[model samples]
Target: MTEIKRPTWAISNPLMQQYYDTQWGIELHDERALFEMLCLETYQAGLSWQTVLNKRSAFEDAFHHYEIEQVAQMTETQIAPQLKNEKIIRNRLKLNATVNNARTIVKLHVAGRTFDDYIWQFVDYQPQRLVIQKDENLPAQTRLSVQVSKQMKKDGFKFVGPVTIYSYLLAVGVVNARLD
Candidate 1:
């Protein structure tokens, strides 16, 4: 029997290994999960995904398990306390953006759309699966990510630049990662 070793980025420990093997690159249709990923990705700016993954549980707890409605209604002062908690990323901008982004999601819901609907629209509501010949060659930003990031910003989302959106798209499986 042979053991399948994961990529270094994916197998530093149990949590990352589990997340990479079970969830990474899998299409996520749930609105709440999509929202959560968006917030996490925003927090992941300039940081390693493993750092964010390690704090995922604390983040979930701080953000009320990312309950869209609950987080949507959280005020800055309400979330400010989290800055002092060492369990999660403590950046003020990212934390505020998380709440603000939740509000945007709720607004979309009011408009009769879910975050899931809004995001998948960029890809025509289908996952853009790609064959990966070389993992290192995967682009930092793509045309689709650019278009989606522009639209999202116009629609009032924060922390959603092209690079971040590209990462977000990949996380939620709008873009499939078949790295070889």
Candidate 2:
């Protein structure tokens, strides 16, 4: 067997490396997965990716396994105590955004659109692959991300901005930056 070396930004842990290699650049179509990724990415604001990755399972449990309907219906009274939970990010704004984003996810579903569909449409259902030699080459925001952020805000989504949207796009595989 031969060993393969990945880029420096990928954690040395085998599982994290596998996730970065296999899933990070591949386009995802599942609505539930899209919702989960969006929520996680939003919560990732101002936090290290490793922190979110480490607590992903806890987040899944806390957010009802990322079930849109359940999270959508969570009231402040119901979600307030989660801030005390050591499992997930304790930021009030981020927690509230998760609930709010869930409602928006459901609204999109009710409009006969899946979160995957709505999000992927911004890229014309194509992954924007970029050739890069280093992590620093990756952009923090793009015109597409800005447009998407504006539209999402107009649609009443929170915790969304150009930078955040760009992160979401990268996380969900709308953008693939691979050095080739």
Candidate 3:
């Protein structure tokens, strides 16, 4: 039998390539998975996707596998140790933001809405497909992202700036950028 080469997007680093191949643009509908991706995307602010990808497992472990209820209840003391953990990004602000965002996720869940429902509503539950021959042409933010960011911020989510939201949208398949 012969081996086959796989096509992949050329990112700035190897971790980014792994993330793109394993996770990016994949359709995911589960609430827990959606929350996990959103938290990762939030942490990704002001950093490269490769950085987050490299630390993904550490993040999963440190954050209790992204269990919204547990993460929402985590105290500052509980998060303090993560700042010194070399496995994940050591930014204190990003760590706090993840905690705050988890609280928001819990609140929304209490309100009888999943993050998936709220976010997908922005696009009418359809993934916006884009035609791109190169990665450079991919946008960092869009009008829809801006709107979603504004809404999320108003809803008490931290680190959900338009750029991060746009990345989140793309990652969770809300905006699919497949060359067809």
Candidate 4:
């Protein structure tokens, strides 16, 4: 048997490893994927990323694959069932907030602004590469996350607290670790 070289966080978890190898920290440019990550980060509040990763499929199915338009169109009736869904995080507020956040993204698109457009401007349309020698030493939140979270809040995005946004930033490669 051989131990796979992986990020500290991805150790011993096939799903996390797959996410790390295939998705985590990868520079994502698509609006839909970005939106999906943002929503998942919120659901991750007070929970481990591994827990959320495990439920990613359920989240996708419950939220209509996180399509901004489709999710935005969801209502109490649509979201009510998901609150009782065993496969997904069962927090009603968080679930409703997901729909609300989707609606916010839809509003942005209606205003000729894409979620990617609003988020990327924070870094001048460039990824902020980080030189972290130890992932354990990374701050729970950063100045950039604080600033971005505030702006997203003003723009009516829910569940975008600083720490959550920081995680989102890292997951989407808005904040990337220096490979060298």
Candidate 5:
């Protein structure tokens, strides 16, 4: 049997290795999937990706599988219990922002725009691949991320700072920061 070689960031965990090889940087067109990643990135604001990946299933269960309309309808009353969920990150602010972000996505739908279209427009509907010469050269947050984060904030999306938005962009395949 042969072992697969993965990036250092993913090699530490089976889930991370799988996510990197199969899911990460793949173009995701589904609104639900996009919303899920965005929310996951939100929860990962102060944690590691490994932590979020480990709890992805719990999050999906708790947040209605990231269904835009369903999660958008999540009230504070409904979300109150998630703060105590031992399986998930259990951050009150991140949990609240999940619902808030879902509502914002719903508003986007109300305006006849799909969350997919609204997000892809920032890159002019193209997935960008960057040139990375080394790990040290990789960016935590780019100007583009800052721009998107600012616009998202203006549109009432919470927990979307530039660093988080950068990760979201990478996760959704709006930008491919995969190292060569």
Candidate 6:
């Protein structure tokens, strides 16, 4: 029997391992899923990915499964309770940003643009596989992320800084940082 060699970062935790093996670097073109990852990465700011992954279900439940229209319609009345919810990150700003970001996506849809297209255009609708020798070689942010982050903010998104954008890109497979 032979064991598969995975990046050290992915092997330390079961949840991370499963995410790495199943979801990481896989091209995702679904708008709802992309929104979910963006919000998750936003919540991940100043925290670890494990924490966000652990609370993902709670976030999904709280935000109506990251449905852009549903979340965009979430009023303060609906969102106020989440600040007290122990199951999620419970950051008011991040929660608000989630809803705001959803609204941004909805606006894109209204403008006859798809979040799938908007995001994929950055990579020319192709996944970029990078040659990473080790986990340490993974970059926190790249020029692409910076450009995307700037455009996202200009497009009325919130909490989308370069680092978060970089992580989101990796999560959605625009850029594959897998060790080779």
lDDT of 1 by residue, 50-154 (tens): 899989999999999999999988987888799999999999989988888888888898999888889998889889987764334667899999999999989
**TM-score for every candidate vs. truth?**
0.92, 0.92, 0.89, 0.94, 0.93, 0.95
| Model 4 TM-score, 2 decimals | 0.94
After superposition on all C-alphas, the RMSD of every candidate to the true structure, in Å, is: 2.1, 1.9, 2.8, 2.5, 2.2, 1.6
The candidate scoring highest on lDDT is 6
Expressed as tens digits, the lDDT of each residue in 1-180 for candidate 3 is 543222344355676666666677777688889999998988788876777777889999999999889999999899999999999998888899888988998898899998889889998988888656653467889999999999999999888999999989988989987444
Ranking by lDDT: 6, 5, 4, 1, 2, 3
The residue pairs in collision within model 5 are none
lDDT of 2 at 93: 91
> What TM-score should be assigned to candidate 3?
0.89
Model 5 gets an lDDT of 0.89
How would you encode candidate 6's per-residue C-alpha lDDT over 1-180 as one tens digit per residue? Answer: 545457888998899999988788788998899889899999999999899999999999999999899999999999999999999998899999999998999999999999999999998999988767655657789999999999999999999999999999998899987655
Model 1, runs deviating above 4 Å: 1-8
Alpha carbon lDDT of each predicted model: 0.87, 0.84, 0.83, 0.88, 0.89, 0.91
Off by over 4 Å in 6: 1-4
* Candidate achieving higher lDDT, 1 or 5: 5
Q: Model 4: per-residue lDDT, tens digit, 14-106?
A: 788788777877888899999999989999999998899889999999998988899999989988888789999999879988989989988
Worst 10 residues of 1 by lDDT: 1-10
Collision count of model 3: 0
Screening candidate 2 with a backbone cut-off below 3 angstroms (N, C-alpha, C), the clashing residue pairs are: none
For each candidate, how many residue pairs have backbone atoms clashing (under 3 Å)?
0, 0, 0, 0, 0, 0
Candidate with more favorable, higher TM-score: 2 or 3: 2
Error of 4 at 19 (Å): 0.7
